[model samples]
Target: MQITVNAQPHEITSNTLDAALIELGFASPAVATAVNGAFVARGKRAETPLAEGDRLEVLAPMQGG
Candidate 1:
């Protein structure tokens, strides 16, 4: 399926958010996810379904001084 991650187009084979994260090598606790402008809880990633043209955002925590 084709989806946009952090404003970049990517072709992924996973059907769920969790699966996609793992497939994309983003299986990290510091990462945050949002689908189609809505935030998805970490626990819900496994159940969150993704579709074509969906906008998925993967954000990592930023540390500042």
Candidate 2:
């Protein structure tokens, strides 16, 4: 399916958010996810379904002084 990740177009084969993250090389658990402007918790990623043209945002925390 075709989806947008971080404002970029990506073709992925996973149907769920968790699988998609793994397929997209986002295996790190230190990131947060949002689908179509809504936040998806880590425990819910496995149940969160994704569709074509959906917007997925993966954000990683940054450490500052």
Candidate 3:
């Protein structure tokens, strides 16, 4: 399926958010995720379904403040 990841077009095989994160090379549990402008919790990522054309935002914590 085709979806937008971090404002960029990406193709993934997983149907759920968690799996898609792995497929997109974001396996770390520290990252935050939001789908279509809505925040998805870590526990809910496995149940959150993703569809084509959905906007996915992945944010990793930054250091050095």
Best by lDDT: 2
**TM-score to native of every candidate shown:** 0.94, 0.96, 0.97
Error of 1 at 65 (Å): 1.5
lDDT of 1 at 39: 97
Of candidates 2 and 1, the better by TM-score: 2
- Model 1 per-residue lDDT tens digits across residues 1-65: 99999999999999999999999889787789999999999999999999999999999998998
Q: Which parts of model 3 have CA positions greater than 4 angstroms off?
A: none
Q: Which ten residues in a row have the lowest lDDT in candidate 2?
A: 22-31
Instruction: Supply the global lDDT for candidate 3.
Output: 0.97
- Residues 3-58, candidate 3: write the lDDT tens digits: 99999999899999999999999989999999999999999999999999999999
Error of 2 at 16 (Å): 0.2
Off by over 4 Å in 2: none
The models' CA-based lDDT, in order, is: 0.95, 0.98, 0.97
Tell me the TM-score of model 3.
0.97
Error of 2 at 49 (Å): 0.5
Which residue pairs of candidate 3 clash?
none
Preferred candidate (lDDT higher): 1 or 2: 2
